[model samples]
Target chain A: MISSPENTAAVNIHRDDIGTRMGIWLFLFTELLLFGGMFFIYSIYRFLHQNEFHLAALELNVIVGTFNTAILLTSSLTIALSIAAIQNDNKKLSVILQIMTLVLGAAFLVNKYFEWMAKINHGIYPGSDLLLSKKPGEILFFGLYYVMTGLHGLHVIIGMVLIAVMLRLTVRNKIDSNNFVRLEAAGLYWHLVDIIWIFLFPLFYLIT
Target chain B: MENMPEQNQKKNNTGYTKYILVWFTLIILTGLTVSLAGMDLGRITVATALLIASIKSSLVLSVFMHLKSEQKAFKVFVLVALFFIVVSFVLLFSDYSSY
Candidate 1:
């Protein structure tokens, strides 16, 4: 019996979730390598300029960093829960959880903005004269701090966008139980963003 | 082999309470790491902080990312990527530690 062309195509798509996962995992590996290179540079610089890095870390506000850590961690939990909600076919709860995740993410960026503003106000940014005149070790430490955390902030923004889109799709019923791979993939991306910050928290704010 | 029937039956096996538990543990670990920084443990602070961070991230990855239930092939792919991260760290640090 010859199945209709549409039916065959539908079956093929349904059967290839693993391929979809494989593609995303490959993409995630490349991301790992990208951040891994930055970390390599960070380690070498920290080793050579341990004293400067320590003093530089002292300038960071541990309170704000700790708050942002809690915020990001909460957001991670929300996103993971959203995936579970959708898998159980609770579309409304899933959307609510995603929205919650986005709010937590926005809160994190707001906190980060205040932190960076405080630093930039003091001329602590990369290439500022006050920073430029410091020992090269100190300069390198702050430079890596801004670049690593800034890159991480960018990831947070991207994760928010992904969650926003997924939330919209979930609302439209485009991401229900039968087609939740999209939601799952976005959750993985969001978790990676949190994982990066997990490491970043200690290196920047607590290493003093 | 992750047959088609089993794949179709796949749904998240984790309970909602587990996510909360993980989050609580992560928050407590963050507090510990921050407090450790203030105690003047010298170099051990950095080591202890990173060790806790690793533990926290492992929970996020294994549970939240659903790596524990993922196929063995994908698990290997992830492990290989992590191996490269370690490789880059060790080979580069070997050259820099003496300088």
Candidate 2:
């Protein structure tokens, strides 16, 4: 084996691919567990106060929750398509698809804002008098509702930024067809976000 | 952005039509689950909704995430991760089930 710099660089680059994917998967696993722990709390609380949790869920807008689910689902599709475009070396289509994904993400956030605003306007926000006056179980339900959904919303923003960065790189030819796992990694993260929402929807909005 | 072979390798790209098909199926599933929630099916509603959601996410994991095309080692890791999540839930619930 020649110990030349070129040989080392080539091996390292290939290894880096597998290594990076493993790293991202590891990171995502942690994220899943983090939310899993929270879901644990949710289950315990719901079991302790099934009635209140049902009431709390009734306060949520199933329509909005369903719409947001659709938006996230659509975004996931667009992200997958964008990766396919990149793998096919059609950078233009990849960029276009990415832009569409970004738009869908923004739409999700926009709907989220309106949903939260409606709650706030109705004095149903965290720490509001209505919440403080509720039974402990109901309070916990809403608290977890806000916290979990808020965290999911944050991930949406992060995912959007990631897609945007990928789009920029694709446009600049930094992420080409031969090497677009980074974009695939982004898609994976986005799908994870969608997956979390899938569970959250049934737990929070549909359990009634 | 790692994982490229030294020589450019041609990876199988899922067609746009297939993606659209998966996307459509996902949307239809979403609608079904939402409407299922509205029906007064007692305990069955929760079970049914969750079961449908699980199906949708499975479609997403296999297609959108390309888990089907992924390496065997990676697939095993994913399975293990999922197994642990279930284990954690069961173990933690054991404590609460008594309470």
Candidate 3:
């Protein structure tokens, strides 16, 4: 059987890097449209209630949002660098960069926690009495705010878990310079998360 | 070792310089957006914010996400997805704008 040409071709065809990558890209497109639908909803609501959206946006801290944006962008850079490091056969550097990406992701979430905490302390969370007492437009604004940012935050956590798995694979030599598509896929996911925040930051925290 | 393909030999040789440069550009864009938010852009405020965000996201898509180096098929798929998204936005907004 080992000598048969049919089995040889079958074995050779078992690994398809391009196919794996294309699969992830397809998954990413679905992710994009998922958030794109939310963005569309946000735009319509903002258009319907421009003044309330503006006023509600002002309640958010621009400084915190900008800082978090910077952190995510930096994480994108670090994850990209990690891919480059792994490609260039610098395993140690790749792992370090992956760790840096995780740290930045954690920092972004930590900032988000504090921001949400501040809002919650002020009784501005979803379905809170203070929020319910607000105008309908204000309620919608905060409602979208919590849903959109909360979903993006969830993606950040998922991306970190994916990266952590890739890190373990790298350590075990399952993903090395010769076969780093897993790491690349993980990086792509992280970048998508960052891209989502890129739009979310402005729509929610800016444009006031 | 036997399963590694020839494509694996053609590793993604992207350097760190490009990533760092993109990172800096993104930071500057973030600063610009924040500062612009303070101005009284009126009706164009959301447009401006969105335009800048689009620019930043494109940069991330091309550089960080490796779309620039990806296959033509990937690019075409992205364009198709984006076209559908644009269609949805235009269709939805047309309804809202139609009185």
- Model 3, stretches more than 4 Å misplaced? A1-13, B1-12
Clashing pairs in 2: A17-B2, A17-B3
lDDT of 3 by residue, A1-208 (tens): 6579987786565567778889999999999889998999998998899889988988999999999999999999998898888888889999999899999999999999999999999999989999999998899999999999999999999999999999898888888777888998898899889889988998889867
Which candidate's lDDT is highest? 3
Each model's TM-score for chain A is 0.94, 0.93, 0.94
Ranking by DockQ: 1, 3, 2
Worst 10 residues of 1 chain A by lDDT: A11-20
**For each predicted model, how many residue pairs clash, with residues at least 3 apart or on different chains?**
0, 2, 0
List DockQ, one per candidate, in order. 0.74, 0.66, 0.74
Give the candidates in order of lDDT, highest first: 3, 1, 2
B1-99 per-residue lDDT for model 1 (tens digits) = 556553344654436888889899999998888888889887588789889999998999888888888888878988888888888878897887778
List model 1 lDDT by residue over A113-148, tens digit each. Answer: 999999999999988999999989889989998999
Question: Fraction of the real A/B interface contacts present in each candidate?
Answer: 0.83, 0.83, 0.88
CAPRI-style docking class of model 3 based on DockQ:
medium
Q: List residue ranges in candidate 1 displaced over 4 A.
A: A1-15, B5-9, B12-14
CAPRI band for model 1: medium
- Which residue pairs in model 1 clash with each other? none
